[model samples]
Target: MLTKYPTPKKLAHANLSKLTEILWNSSNGRFGEWKAQELKNLAHDSFGVENCEDIYSMALLTMLDEIQSLAEKADELEKKISSLLKNFDSTITSVPGIGPILDACILSEIGDVTRFRSADKLAAYIGVDPSVNQSGEYTSDHTRLPLPAKSRLDGLCCCCAA
Candidate 1:
C-alpha cells in the first residue's frame, strides 16, 4: 500500500475499511471479510507509532528497494554460477545431496585429488579427517574433526561421514 499512501503516517491514518477494501480488491476477493478483520487486528496490535514522518518513510522505502535489488543480483549471480558449473564433470554433481554450489565449493577447494597421496591425506587437507588421541592403553573415539577456515565446508565432513 506504499504506492497509495507513500508514508507510514499516511498508512497509519488510513481508514480501516478502505485498507481492507484495497486488500480484498487486490487479492481478487481471495481476502474476504475474515481476512480483512485479521489484518485490521494485526494493524491495531502492531502499529504503535502515532506519527511517522514522510522523510523517514522515504528512507525506509529506499532501504527496502536497495535490499530487493541486492537480493535480485545475488539470485542472478547464483544462476550464472550454476550454469557455469553444469559444464564441468557431472561426477561431482552425481554424488547424493551435492548440488551445483556444493560441487563448485569442493572443486574449488580441492583442485586436484591426485596431488594427495591417499584419500586420507585428501580428507585431512579438507579438515574432514577425524582427530586421534591415545594415552597408555586408552584411546579416544576420535569423533571430532577440526573445522575448516571456510565455514561453508565445515558441514562437508559431517555429510561425508554420514
Candidate 2:
C-alpha cells in the first residue's frame, strides 16, 4: 500500500544534515560530535549573545547539531530501552500482543509508562485506538486517526522498527 518509500529516507537525511549544521555552528565546532551536556550550556549562552552575526551563525549551527544529536540519542535510547524492557516484569511485557522490543519503543517515547493513568490513554496516545462516535441511540466506529501528539506518532514508528 505504501508508494513513497524513498521520500522518508531522503527527508530524514536532509533533516539530519540541517540539524548537524545548526549544532556545528552553535558550538563553533568546539563541541565536535559528542555534546549532550554541552548543548545545555550552549542553550544557556544563547540568551546572552550580543552580536547579530555571531547569533545568526550560532542559531543556524545549533539547529543542525540538535538534529544530529537527537537522532543519535534516540537510537541509543531505543537500544537501552529494549534491554531494560526485556528485564521488566509486567503485563505490558507479558501480554500476548506485546514484545520486549515493542515495549521498549513505547517506553522510550512515552518517557514513563506509569505516567499513563489508563490503558485507553496509552492506546490513544500511540494512535492505535479506534475512534468511536455516539449520538442519541446511534453509535459509530471509525478508523484509526492520527495521534494528536507528534511524539506519540514517533513512538509508534519506533515500535514498528522493533
Candidate 3:
C-alpha cells in the first residue's frame, strides 16, 4: 500500500472504497472484500489522526519499515551462521541437553580442545571450576564458582549447565 501512497497523509485522505478495492484486488480475494467501515476504523486507529500534519503516523511507519528490514537481515545472518556451523564435526550437540547454538558456543570458546591438558583445565577455562581458599593449614572448602571474566565463555558454560 505504501507503494501506491508513500505517505500516511496521502493514505489518510485517500478514498475508502478505492483503498478497500485496491486491498481486495491486490490480496487476490484473501481479504474478502473489506468493508469501508472496517477500513475507516483501521485507518483511524493506525494513522492516529484525521489530518496528516497533526500526526506522527509517517514516522511510526518509517520506524516499522526499518524494524522489518533489520529483522530480515538478522534472519539471513542466522541462516548463514547455522550453515557454517553445520560444516564442523561436533559431538557436543549430541549430548542430550545441548543443541546447535550451545554446541557452537562451546566449540567457539574452546577451540582446539587438545590445547587444554585435561578436562579440569577446560572447566577452569570456561569458569566452571570451583574457587578454593586455604590459610595456615586450615582450608576453606570450595563452595562457589567465580563468575567468568570472559563473558562469552560464561555464556557457554551457563548454556551447558542448563
Candidate 4:
C-alpha cells in the first residue's frame, strides 16, 4: 500500500523502522485490535479456528517459545565466546583497545596476521581499505570495496584506537 520507492539503504531502514513500529504498536490500542483481527482471519482461513481467543493464546505462546529458544541459543553462543576469549586472552591482551574477546575474534577470523605483505594489503584483505581510482595521473580515494578481509582490518583498527 506504500507508494514510496526506497533505495537500498532507505529500504533497509524503512523495514527496520516498520518492525520497530509494529512491535511498539502491538503493545496497545487499534494496532493490537488490527493484529488480533488479522491473526483471527488467517487462523480461521488456514486452521479452521472458529474461536479467535484460542488462536490468539496459541500465537502468543508460540511467540514466547520462539523468544525462549532464541535466548537459549544466544546464551550458548555467549558461553562459547567466553571460553574462546579465555583461551586467547593472554595473547591478545597486549594489543591496545582490544581485550580477550576482541583479540579472540580477530585471531580466529584473521588466522595469521603476519602472512599479510603490507598494512594496505592487510587492510584490503580485511575489507576496510578505502578504494582508490588510478586513471592516468589522476588518483583519488574511492568507495570501499566488498571483501571478507575488511573485518580483520576493522578489528585491527579497533585494537590500535584503544
TM-score of each: 0.60, 0.35, 0.54, 0.43
State how far residue 10 of model 1 sits from its true place (Å): 4.1
Tell me, by lDDT, which candidate is best.
3
lDDT of each: 0.71, 0.57, 0.71, 0.57
- Candidate 3: Cα lDDT at 154: 89
**TM-score, cand. 1:** 0.60
Q: Number of clashes in model 4?
A: 7
| lDDT digits (tens) for residues 1-162 of candidate 3 | 665555545665678777777887878876633554465556556743446643455666677799889999978877776788888876786788886667767787789888989988888877778877777998886568867757798876666777
What does each candidate score in C-alpha RMSD?
A: 5.2, 15.9, 7.1, 12.6
* Tens-digit lDDT track of model 2 for 13-59: 33334445556776777654445334434444444334464555556
Residue 36 lDDT (model 2): 32
Error of 2 at 12 (Å): 41
lDDT of 1: 0.71
Candidate 3 worst ten-residue window by lDDT: 47-56
Our model 2 lands, by Cα RMSD against the true structure, at: 15.9
After TM-score superposition, the amount by which residue 128's alpha carbon in candidate 4 deviates from its true location, in angstroms, is 2.2
Q: Write the per-residue lDDT of candidate 4 for residues 71-153, one digit (tens) a residue.
A: 99988886787776664424656755665556666677777778898988766777767777688998875665665555555
Higher-scoring candidate on lDDT, 1 or 2? 1
